[model samples]
Target chain A: MPERAEWIAVDWGTSALRIWAMRGSEVLAETRGSEGMGQLAPEDYEAVLLRHAERYLAGDRVTEVLVCGMAGARTGWREAPYRAVPCTPAGEGAVKVPVRDERLKVRILPGLSQARPVDVMRGEETQIAGFLAGRPRFDGVICLPGTHTKWVQISAGEVVSFRTFMTGELFALLAGQSVLRLSVASDGHDADAFRDAVGDAISRPESLGAALFSLRAGSLLEGLDPVVARARLSGLLIGLELAGARPWWLGAEVVLIGSAAVAEPYREALAAQGLAAELVSGERMALAGLIAAREVMA
Target chain B: MPERAEWIAVDWGTSALRIWAMRGSEVLAETRGSEGMGQLAPEDYEAVLLRHAERYLAGDRVTEVLVCGMAGARTGWREAPYRAVPCTPAGEGAVKVPVRDERLKVRILPGLSQARPVDVMRGEETQIAGFLAGRPRFDGVICLPGTHTKWVQISAGEVVSFRTFMTGELFALLAGQSVLRLSVASDGHDADAFRDAVGDAISRPESLGAALFSLRAGSLLEGLDPVVARARLSGLLIGLELAGARPWWLGAEVVLIGSAAVAEPYREALAAQGLAAELVSGERMALAGLIAAREVMA
Candidate 1:
């Protein structure tokens, strides 16, 4: 009477969890919850995961569940140790998360780590692997923009090196918590202002600190628009990231893999810098990456 | 038989209210409270001040209360307004607040504002006035480091020009609230680590966003000491501020006016860059500036 999952794919990050009931690669049903790794204790994770996947599970057979993201972190359900870079994003090393629910068989793919620059990524590696799955010979940089935007360099379908920026987190904190909150709107868009701020930050990267305060100052002295202030704040932070990540994006074929809401700005910013980045769906990549890992197991 | 005051000098900033029971320039009894401008509804300011100054007040005579800082802000008790820059810090404008108690005669000093860069300072102006009052012919840069660190250029007893940085605030947010919180300790100092981070940020300002994330990464990967991480985080933010404020400090006679706890890092960082900064007591400067303001009224 109810739809059953052939298998399951889960993307559990710090603040939220999303699981898809998959018939191989095609989704049969999808659901999400706020029970992310950050809020859950080591033992509390199993109940949350099972609660989300209950409707998709049958009483008789064990459903294979493949996970990516913070669920693989040390503090997650069970630690899936990080795989050193110069390796495939999600090919091997999916640590089985021992669960009491015999109806579910769970495996969390290990995240990637770099020693030199000192960087790590949990969920994005699966997306990177998914992006590379279709293009086995893909050689370029993949930019995944989110709370922690990552710039990953791919060569011969392997992640060579990567770096992460806290631009998104910083923007959230500044806009919501810092003094800039008084000057910025919670919801608004000003494309021209964003472009101008990006250009300003790129040209004078050293003035980042002063430029931030100028938003608040501009509001006080000139009655600067809250919408414009919000847009400029976003641009300045992203621009600083772009400037920091010039080595990864400059003169390289760059693909932006993120949600439209998050990835579009990077596309626009990069375009202004004379680099046209092809934008792709982050959800699709995560699914594809999970499927790729499942196929290997099969 | 109780200790009483001839007048009161109050610095009402955002978080705290510090008042001194003074006989002209000498403090007879000093007391402080948490009733700052940020928390009160403005109309509530008189009661809080009276509460702190009660023991120091006499029923027969009106006690003159001289106040500086955010208490004079637009959202503060009563808008004292701001005097545009290229002017003396605390010479002319002082707004009289209407109070219920005849025992209180309150006057709030106006702050300094810059038109072009669009900056404003309330409490710091008094400190600057104090610094300049003692050195009338001083022509140099005064560095006031705090939550919002200010770089003020002085010439001919006037503010001339100034800029503000959110370096301290940024460090606080990143170290205490952001992802780096897990890696950085709340207390500790590593001079060498601080110096290295300053050099790293100064040498490559563009890598600031990435460099910040590296501290967290370094901890996760190499067990980076939390104390070292804390120092490095402070250094990075301050170094970025220094780089941004280069125009204000380059080849200038720099004197740092702040608490030793707040000013020492800036002094050391400047020394590392071959610029020696003479550190002075912030409390003394503020009191001096308030005294100077009171003297003007006399």
Candidate 2:
């Protein structure tokens, strides 16, 4: 005998996919795959989703599927239109997709968009919803860090305005692909070096570009440690982001929603800047957000 | 009758090899190939030089070869150690590479390096030499923009100090490899958008990361033109470089060495800040630099 899955929840992005077998507001089982939206054709998405969720399926009964992120993008499985800003992050406006398997009924949730300053986010909105569900009266900024780190303002339980930065992506390119690659290692960092770099960039944000090349120069001339080099690179980019995002988090209570590894730096950097940031697990928030959406759409 | 080769000038970079056939100080014929340092082995560099200059080979007599750039890097043909900063850019101490063909007598010129801020430049030293030889008394800043844009301070005839920026490389990655690629065109620009972006970054350098993402959001929300997005991207990076390099060129005579395409935006941006810039052709500078090096080495 196997546990029956009442519904399915998915968070899909450019590189990977994660799914949860939900029984009402509770998750019964969890799984994910590398068959992300980027590698899938419109017709290929259904098969990947179904294959990954097969083990959780108990019978021929229909499994309500709720998805957020790139699956709703225009180039993804099916186009789920965006819900404009100043609105709740939910599955209310989710668009249904016809599936070959009668056991699968899917709805892709819409992302959020701002018109004036021009900003958008997909899967992170689901985490925002989950964070809001646990604290409905929460009114502050939600800093969601990833490849494209997003800083969103919430007032009276609705998203007011938001901005995104390419900090993580920039670090990846500089460390792994740029000329700085030879000077930096994949892991290990010096805390003192990270702190010094943070202070340097934050104090003089103008020197960011020159400081980047200095990593290579430092390695060549002064025998700078590779660990310190990696740490300094991370510190510089994050410090630059902190300098830019000061307006959003200056005197405000912030909730950081992301993995421990990614969120830790923001927390440390904020602390270094004299701010307290509350932490939330990105995975759990995604799950909670999906379960909440299922209650409205299923 | 075939032309005789009295000398050879070669620029071996990471991606391309260019050589000029010279009779005394005048170039007789010039040829280049895609056999860059990144694509060839240590032993493969000699064959490339010989084959490209085969037409200029005369009576098996020793053909004096003067080379610049990455061919002398540790990973290149044979490492020609770098000369410390606050020194004249000369070929007097260039390392001679032993070759199989007696017809090819090669000496790879040493690059310049600084200890404190940690900076180095290989091929650009030759350009600096060329510029100085033509205008021996000119004293100011020499800015060479490319994948790694270099800003050098020349007091008298020596490269006193310098800094390098990853601006051009960042533009290439963001415009071609990052998510911003979807919203940017290859070879088009909006000058007005470019100027506005430059002013924005120059005045508020901290907002660079956020402003980068705005390009994508603008496309998604306001139908921002791809050409405008491309221009804005270039302007932002260059403006950021200028902000960091203010000490080098502000209120001082500046010389820009590069192609029209690469130097155009820098020129415009400098003009925006009330700084007039004199442009120099990079190819001619390289040839002149080689000629200067040959006069010493030959």
Candidate 3:
């Protein structure tokens, strides 16, 4: 007989789903899918989880699932009303869903919101919580680079204030749908081009509008390479984000929690500005976060 | 039979083709089509124009066709290399394409390019040329808002300097393709929301990233109306454009040339900033510019 399941850690977002079979602090098995909240109806969440976890499930064993991200959104499985910020980022305020199956006990964690600046985050809070669990005394800015990149402030084990930037979404749209698509390559990087664009964007941030259109003009006038074009586009967008994030990152000890692909550019950009930033593997943080949330479930 | 064409004025853009059947300075008839440069091969341009102008091409006599916009692009009918800046926006150095149809004489006019800021505009140059012809001695800024908005400066019949902003494209992408698309509406505008957003964006342009995400957050947390969401998005983008364009529009005699629908927001934005500007019909300006360019042809 297989070892009985203890609990599951799930990160259910709009477009992707990730789950780890966990026993205490150790992850036993992991699985991910495209069956995220956007692709499933409210009633289908239980079945979908079971289908992906077939290999890990044991006969007649009840499994506790700790969930985060859009699974708790109004459009997701069930609405977990946001816990307004100045609160700890953790398993607290979780919403319990009455599942049809007796074998599943699911608790979806609540996201954090700021009332004054009017900001909110779904998945990154759990990652922040996990980072905090690992480094209890650490207090500074945590940069989470994703579709909506976030800069979070932490003090006394609570999320103080945070801001979100649409840098990644802008890059994706421009690279795929905008005129720059002709000049942008799918996979390449030019360090020199990126560094120069970052410098220009920070000093003359308002030039972003004119500079965006220049990708086409430069391609037409100077035959600019696609790799350079892609790099410049990425650089300009990130540089603009940094310009907005200076207050949160300049004097603070910054740590970037994201995939190597996304976090590397931010680390380089922060370094160019004379700041040393540490990057932590986002998968580890996410699994740790979900595990931490599960330990507190009823 | 329909009246034979005296001259044809064409605005062959990326996705649309527009032509005016004219005699002297008066338009006898006007027709436009979606068969723009994007939909045609180099050899296919002559046939497409002939098909669309069949009603007016009654005689064996060659009808002069004055063309502008991407029809002069390298990928269009024939290449008309851009005219470097600090020159008059007109029939200077137009490229003549040898046509298969004996009844047509086609000349594609050149677009304007700036070397320093690295900007370019194709069809807007024709409108600016027409605006300048109507007010020959008038000297100031002419704002042409569209997919790619242009701000042109004229002094003594010469386009002294100019800049282009990708405001419209950004709006389309953000509202149609990004995460904010869930909250943005197509057919509504909140005047108060727009005015206030414009004020905030102008004062703190760097806050654009956070402000954009706030559209979704506000929708989730505060039940934001889609119309208000759209207006805020538009206001923030245009405000950013204006912030970059402060050097061109401030203290200048500004004229807006475009379709009423597209130019209305710009006019309101300028008014919100306490600027009195004149509005001109883009079609009329384009026809005038083409007529003026035809007069220069040998």
Candidate 4:
């Protein structure tokens, strides 16, 4: 192994794979590829990685390769055990596994977990750590919305706890494939209907299970405009999330990490709960997590 | 018009077209076709109805035609007003409209509605009334589980009030077409997983919105077997229904009208709620509805 390596970190997620050769906090070389874990084949995963590495690293000698996120998941290279919650970047340890050849050593970061019912997360832990990297002193709630929406709470830089909501996945199912598909308009926001539905959802949250039926009932009874039903569904789902997460997050400050389109509704939902929040780009957090993982490995 | 003609009733559901020719309470002939309103062009609707009617009648003369279900809605042949709930077999009147030549008089049954917040039912109301037919007096909750499920409170041969659930539609969307489709096993039922999920959904009814996340999370965290997730989803949705309906339905006799396979889970869900329910065939209710609708026109 070389005494020192040129590149510092690599981050892979659901949508894209990104590599950063960092010298401390500064990036020396960066390369991106279309190798999201969802699209990779198990047999050719290593080959795909090598191709991307060759494109970016050329012949540079590297001592270590650290990966965070889905690539370390069961679908990716290897399944890494999850670290239980009430964890922090400083306290959490990286799980190091040797790569295929002796020349390369890879450390697959451990994900976060909750006991009792037993819930866990993989890539998001790194993102949480990355979010903490720049704002290490910050504390309170952090929401990462996507296919599986995460509502995380942090205290003194440690991830105290978190819960997951299937907002995005449900939205996709309802809007793309369900009967409601006939009603969903374009992707643009419908603020009025969104606010109305969010309000209804939060007020009588117990009715949420029954409320879902309204999407069909509304259309059947009153010719519920499909666009409105779409917004109502979005509202009911977010409202349920707020109702579930609110008990744990009454007065905590909220930091939302995701794309603008995804994060905006959540921001509005939180605001409906009378909780104010700040928005942080998910890309930056991934980058931040890559940097943190690198530092820990160093 | 013939001096005395037999009764003809038509059921226009979302998928198929059914016609019944009845003399008093006895059904003389029954025929089905692929002429659902959903598949017909607006201009060709009359032609479709006439063709189907002729095929079913086979030259038999019909005195009065009573059409129920979606065929009467704004999107149907003619817009029929909704009947406010606390409705009775006698109160269930139809809106008279002209079809083709022969001064054809067809009565479109009105849907039932609730004041204030505004909940309503269309075809299910007729089915519920039909289910109540012949019995001297039947009271309690009757559940019509289908693409749009209806939970109706019936008393003294009247539909007092009801709530709708979109269970079947959601199941089709999730298991048949959504991303979750990748996780479902098509061979048969997974009873154990179904029961486990039913327990989870019923125990913490409010957790339904969160519970859906388990489909993706289970796969991510615990190597959630796809088939199990599918069953879990089915259980969770039914569990939510049991939870919501339990408040109004505790101690009330329950009758579920639908296919045995579809209604069995609901029966199990109700049992989980400490409630017992009888399974009634949906086909019987459809036929009963045709008889009742014929009687109304008579």
Candidate 5:
């Protein structure tokens, strides 16, 4: 007989749902699907989870499922209310979800919220928790780059405060849907172009609106290369975020938690300004976070 | 017998093609169609123009049609090359499109271009010319608000320089398409919310990315009113523009050229910044500019 799973670790986000069949702290099996919390109704969450997890389940005993990310959102399986900041990331505030399947005991971890700047994180709290678990002594900023990049302040193992920027979404919309779409390449990068744009934006962010339109004009007037334009667009947005996020990163020990593809650009931009931030794998952090939450449930 | 038009004035923009059947500056008739330059190819421009102005044409004599805007774009009827700045708005350069129909003589006015910052404008130049025609010695800044807002510096009856902002387009993309769409109302304006947001953005332009995301967070956490959110979105974008365009408007005579619907927000935002700008009808300026161009052709 196949080994029965001891517990499950799930990271459910807007676009995808990933679950790992865990035997204690070790992942025995893993699977993911496009049926994310964004698309699924609250009633559909149980079946979706069971579909990927059924093979690892033992009919004789119930298995505890530790869920993180958007699955705990108000629209997800059950609303795991946010723990307002100046609180520990992914502490003991996991909400017990009433599941139709008797074999599954699911608890979703609560996200962190900041009232002043009015910021909230659905899934990154767990990732932050996971990162903090490994480095409890670390203090300073945690930059989580994604669709909505979050700059979180961490001190004494608690989320002191946080702010979010729509840099990624803005970049996607401008390069894909705006007039610049005609000028920018869908895939490619120019490091020099990116660095130049980052410098320009950091120095004078007020000119961002004019600078963006110039890309379209530049393409028409100067025959600007598509690759360079794409890099410049990414650099400008990221640079603007860096400018906005100066309070979080300046003279502070910064750690970037994201895939290398996203985090690398931020790191390069920061390096230009004399900051060498430590980079960590987002997936690993999220899994570690789920493991931490599970230990508390036990 | 129907009164033949002395000359036809046309403003062929991206979304609409507007024409005036004029007899010596007096509008004999006016009509506009949805066949904007955006949806038409080079060959299709003549047919679309004729479909609207055919009634104004004389059988024996050719009808002179003065065209402005994107119809002069490279992909439009014919390429009316941009005249680099430090020149009069609607002065001499007008490209005559070779059309199949002998009854039509179309001359498209050249747009203005700035070299340093790399900016361009098409239809707005005609309006600028018209506005300048009335005030020959008008020396200051002209603020033209549209999908792409233009802040132009006018000195000694010439357009010294200008800057363009994608503020309007940004507002549309964010309020209509971004995640904020769920929080912001599709149609409505809160004056107080707009003023506050404008102030916030002007003071802290770098915080723009964060400020935008807060609208979504505010909606989630505080049930931020949709109308207020919409107004706040507009205020933030416009405030950012005002912040960027400060060099153009600060300590300069500011005249706004746009329809009341589009220009009102700008005037209000500027008013909050202690500037009373003169608002003029956009259509009037375009017609006046077309008249001025026709005189030059004669």
Candidate 6:
């Protein structure tokens, strides 16, 4: 039937491994298995991926396997060369990796790179491609907020450039374990403090270098209620992100892609900046990217 | 002999407490105490200070006491009002806190403050006064680097203005407990990486908003050795401090007052900026400030 299912697209991310079998836009079947890259031992990577693949294959013959996300980097099954900037979905490099058998025909997506001063991203390119695939004519700013919040600019279906801010990580650190933990009262947004911090970040972006001291000073000097100090810290961090990403977003439609857990704050931040943003499901994009990669190879 | 020793000056800080008995610059006697502010309980403050003071007072007619450093703040004996900026050691409005007995004449030094977009300093002022006391004719930049680094500019023995940096705290967090802990290979300086980060900080002080991302990106993408990453983080932090204080330090003689434990790296950082810095002992300053206060009261 259909000359033996041509390919299977796998979106293996930090959290889970998901597979979709499809011919064209129509899906044949979708399955998932527990083989997240984060938990696997470096040596057990192939076994984990293949074992997960077996559950999805269901004894059906599949000719090719396409992998996206952290599965192809140094810690992944194999190292793939990063494609330099000015990259597109169609123009990106693919690494054909040999698993247990040559007949398996596995290809991992390559990441995008920035040369001068050197930076690179592996899993994000696929997400960008998926975004472009769904909205081909979209030309604006796209924000993927996660442990590392990436602000990418897309124009005419190509990633022009991007900058990443450590918003999510800093949030985790400050809220979960850092010195600010003693002060952070709740996870919920403190709207008033957030707005104040955002204004502060934008108005005195340079002061951010000094503004951080406020976290401790607030408590030490003004008797900044510990809870309010927490909120202010959050605001200061997010405000900094807004300030840094402001130049990239000049007069551009803002699009946010990530789990609600990650996207909501970013949306709020963008809204605070007086920018309207369209939310897209990050999981769906991961799937869409896998599908797009399959079609490219086909 | 001066109607018996009237009071004892207790300098209780992070590490140790040194008690001084004086009827002005003429030191009657001094004694070392095992008690430190960090080790004492909130309720035990009076007992603790008295316990140490008792060793030095030794049945002498003690009437009043003057305390500085951690003892004057909340964590210390009592919460004192932070004296706002443009303040001098001799200026009025500095908090004169009363302890246990009114005639005890206990006057804890008032911490400095910055109004409008508030910032404050506690123990650093004493160090500033100590620095000025030692070299009253000296007028320029005086830096007291430690868990909180204070870069202060002085004119005619007055603290014109100053800024506080969390350099020591950041170092402790990053090297001792943060995610970068895994990357910290050497406790000593990595001169090459430190210089690179210093230059990076100076050249793009604004990028500090984004520069932190390099810690993760360096490890993830370019295979940045963790140890180097740790050093780089330290460098970036110190570099940012240098940049933030640059405006205050313009055309000023920089005097670093803190123990070798805290001042060495700051000295290196200053020298990197082509600024000549003279090292002053924080211990000596504390003693000097206590002596100066005793003299003024006399």
Q: Which stretches of candidate 1 lie over 4 Å from their true place?
A: none
Question: Candidate 1 local accuracy as lDDT?
Answer: 0.91
Native interface contacts retained, candidate 2:
0.80
Q: Provide the TM-score of the second chain in candidate 4.
A: 0.88
Candidate 3's error at A39, in angstroms? Answer: 2.3
| Model 4 Cα lDDT, one tens digit per residue, B1-298 | 3223266777777677787766677776777888777776556666776675654442544456777777776677776788877768432567887666452457778777775344666677777767777563888888888777778888877777787767778778767765567666654667888888888866676566567765765666667787788778899877766666665678898888888988888887777667789888887776687677666555
Cα lDDT of model 2 by residue, A1-298, tens digit: 4477888889988899999888888778888899988888999998898788977775667877889889999889998878898888875799999889878888899999888678898899899999888899998999999999999999897889899998998999889988889999999967778878888888888899899999998887788899999999999999999999999999998999999999988888888888989999999998888877766564
Tens digits of per-residue lDDT for model 3 on B10-30? 999999999888888888888
Chain A TM-score by candidate, in order: 0.97, 0.97, 0.97, 0.88, 0.98, 0.85
Please identify model 6 stretches exceeding 4 Å from their true place: A1-40, A43-67, A76-81, A89-108, A175-178, A223-231, A264-275, B1-67, B76-81, B84-110, B153-160, B171-185, B188-196, B215-232, B264-274, B294-298
lDDT of each model, Cα atoms only?
0.91, 0.89, 0.87, 0.72, 0.90, 0.71
Quote the lDDT for A4 in model 2: 76
Which stretches of model 2 miss by more than 4 angstroms? Answer: A58-60, A296-298
> Where does the lowest 10-residue lDDT sum fall in candidate 1 chain A?
A289-298
Q: Deviation in angstroms for A10 in model 1? A: 0.6
The candidate 3 chain B region of ten consecutive residues with least summed lDDT is B289-298
Looking at model 2 chain A, report the run of 10 residues with the lowest lDDT sum: A289-298
Q: How accurate is candidate 2 locally (lDDT)?
A: 0.89
The Cα error of candidate 6 at residue B29, in Å, is 12
**TM-score for chain B considered on its own, for each of the candidates:** 0.98, 0.98, 0.97, 0.88, 0.98, 0.83
Model 5 DockQ, alpha carbons vs. true complex: 0.78
Q: Between candidates 1 and 5, which one is better according to TM-score?
A: 1
Which number leads on DockQ? Answer: 2
For candidate 6, the per-residue lDDT at A235 reads 74
B1-298: candidate 2 lDDT, tens digit per residue: 5587788888888999789989877889889899998888899998988778877887657878899989988889999988998988776679999888877788898888988788888889998988888998888999999999999999888889999998988898899888899999998878899999999998888888899999988888788899999999999999999999999999899999988899988999999999999999988898899898777665
